[model samples]
Target: MSTTAEAPSSSSENPKKDTEENSESRLYQLVKNLTILERRESSLLELSKKRESFPQLAPVLWYSFGTIAGLLQELVAIYPSLSPPTLTAHASNRVCNALALLQCVASHPETRTPFLNAHIPLFLYPFLNTVSKTRPFEYLRLTSLGVIGALVKMDDPEVINFLLTTEIIPLCLRIMETGSELSKTVATFILQKVLLDDFGLQYICHTAERFYAVSTVLSNMVNALIEQPSARLLKHIVRCYLRLSDNPRAREALRQHLPVALQNGTFSKVLEEDPSTRRWLSSLLYALGGEQYNVGSNI
Candidate 1:
């Protein structure tokens, strides 16, 4: 016969160890759920190629992906300790959804106005700022720029100012200076949006002489545009320079490049033909020399 041992009394024992174990288990399960969601999202992306073949399915798929993205964003926001890698991964996926939506809306002008009216400066702003700072995961930067490209079409001055004041200009400049071809292309799109604003123009003027290093970046973007002849990228760079050189000092700094840009003819023609581009050029030329250059006529 063995002596009976009393079970540990709950009131006499520490419950902290059990609580900690429970917490760890809960965290593990949450992480596992998130990982599964992410894998499912990745699998969905592989179906994009088939989307074109089944045109009717594209919008439904985009909506589904977008819903998943929204859920992921909400979950990550709730779980602050979910890890940067996880947040970045989810953000990148959401950005892809946003970009696909943007392209869809862009191709159909009727859809564009409503989409921008609904989302600009609200969903897109924080999303851009979030992805812009995600290091070691620079692909997000490209996607952020795509969002910016879509938002730039909005005729909202406040939105434009927000982008410039948030240090997006310098960030895009850095990426344009150092990133790969595709990255630079996207950065240029975002930079174009910032440069369309008055604050962006002032920033460039203030920093113009101090950062001659940026000249090389500008040159590289120009050369790339020349090589690829991407109308979108070319239009963006021209618009950026037009806003940037709006100040007298900045105009002088950019004077060296003006002749070259003008000689290219495509940029100048676009500026002349496009109402928005024309407005910026007029403002820039007026700032530089007080409306004496006949710039408006060319525009």
Candidate 2:
């Protein structure tokens, strides 16, 4: 009776491809669940404390960078249109979870490259812009800053170039101006790392608007505090100045700001007491002070 019913062809099936597809699906599921874990306020702090839980998600996140973008986009999509100050708990939870995932993703060296390659700054800027505009939402603000800190550690060329092209420096200054102490610490860390590169310093020096922001924020920070951790942050600030002043345009920028710092004895105060921080600032002070300020004793 003619042919037997045609059998579905096993020959056309690819076992290896199926296995990979299944594995990817499993990894994605893991990310989704971890994100869910992040949203519950009761579990949020617990999740952060458990570092062991992070590696499970890291490999998948590193390998599935597109998924990270998609997750962030989806979270933003469902978020309330209200400002950060008035964000509903639901919206805040979603934003918190998304940021936590980003922080974890950015933290690992293996994962960091994929994150940078994925142009995370582009995906993240919308959220960052919101956080910058709203000074409250402490958790959201700190988490956003933490993500920036993690990216700074990567020091990737593309990431640095992207930062230079954006208002990120201004954003960091905004945090410094109004955010919590932890946030200010993170913001300072961001500027310190950003200025570590010649390109970043040059960009700040050449761009009048950016130069103004950097100078003003740093000046205020030094005026505000200089002890222990604050002193530590000042060390980074002085080191950045040293690098910035090395460039002709940046030196001019520094020279103009130096008078204000000197007028307040901000530079001299550090030199008098904080021996640990004194070393980094002395050269910068001398450079800014020209030949009159002897820094030879620092050696």
Candidate 3:
């Protein structure tokens, strides 16, 4: 009797163990399938391979973000190791495919917040250093900046706070100075959005370190104006400066830099040439309490 009871207990445990093993196998297959899908390229059988993956990936990302946080960690980790940034690796193309998919996902308004909430900016900001230093990474850098710039457009306080407190201001200044015209335009958009609100101005003005960084940024923008007299970028930058000077603390911080800018005569020279530039420059000058436009004069 005892032997007969023991045999049934052993048989029952084996079925439970088999069920668990089957569940694990299914899970492994699911992960493998998703990973392959994320990196899939179009082939004879799969004409829209990458495009098809986005919709599939988006929901999985949305529903399973917390559970598979390591997927994001891996995504962020593999960025610098991609083709242009590094030589051909075993999975360079795959990683690039994944990042490109991510960029598409971020571009969607519905998916954007969830994607940003995953804290992708934290990973993305460091790539700007590579962008600043390497030619190969320039395209990657510009695309990355475009994505981050798009997130900034959301104007979420969490995103804005992260941007303001980081080295992003200095990085944006550097890109504006050294990046290609298209990159420069995007960098200015980032800068413009960053400094659009009182919060950004106050953030800069409240701290000596930030105020100095922004002062340097303002100087660089003025220099950009001098270099590219006809560039539309300078027009937006001039307006950005005027917005900065609106804050009392910012006005005071700017007061110290006004003399050097005015002394250079870049503004004076440009003022006579571009009417729109002149309007923004005049507003900037007035904000700094330096020069008032004479309503009756040619100015």
On lDDT, the candidate that comes out on top is 2
lDDT of 1 by residue, 86-135 (tens): 55576556545534544544334444444445543344334433333454
* Sliding window of 10 residues with minimal summed lDDT for model 3: 39-48
Which has the higher TM-score value, candidate number 1 or candidate number 2?
2
Residue-level lDDT for 281 in candidate 3: 66
Lowest lDDT 10-residue stretch of candidate 1: 53-62
How does candidate 3 score on lDDT?
0.60
The sequence of per-residue lDDT tens digits that candidate 3 reaches over residues 249-293 is 777777677535443454565567678867766666666664442
RMSD of 3: 12.7
Residue pairs clashing in model 1 are: none
112, model 3: CA deviation in Å?
3.1
Alpha-carbon TM-score of each model against the true structure: 0.47, 0.71, 0.65
- The C-alpha stretches of model 3 lying farther than 4 A from their native spots are 1-34, 37-100, 131-135, 165-167, 259-278, 290-299
lDDT of all the models against the reference? 0.53, 0.65, 0.60
lDDT of 1 at 217: 69
* Candidate 2 wrong stretches, greater than 4 Å: 1-47, 53-56, 62-70, 77-84, 88-94, 131-136, 226-229, 259-276, 294-299
For model 2, residues 1-299, the per-residue Cα lDDT tens digits are 68888889876388888876766665556554544534334433344455354455666655553556545664566435535447555665656666676688787777777776666756555545555344335666677777878888877766677776766887788777777677777878888788887788778787778777787887777666643335556666676667777877778677767535433454564556677567666667677774555555442
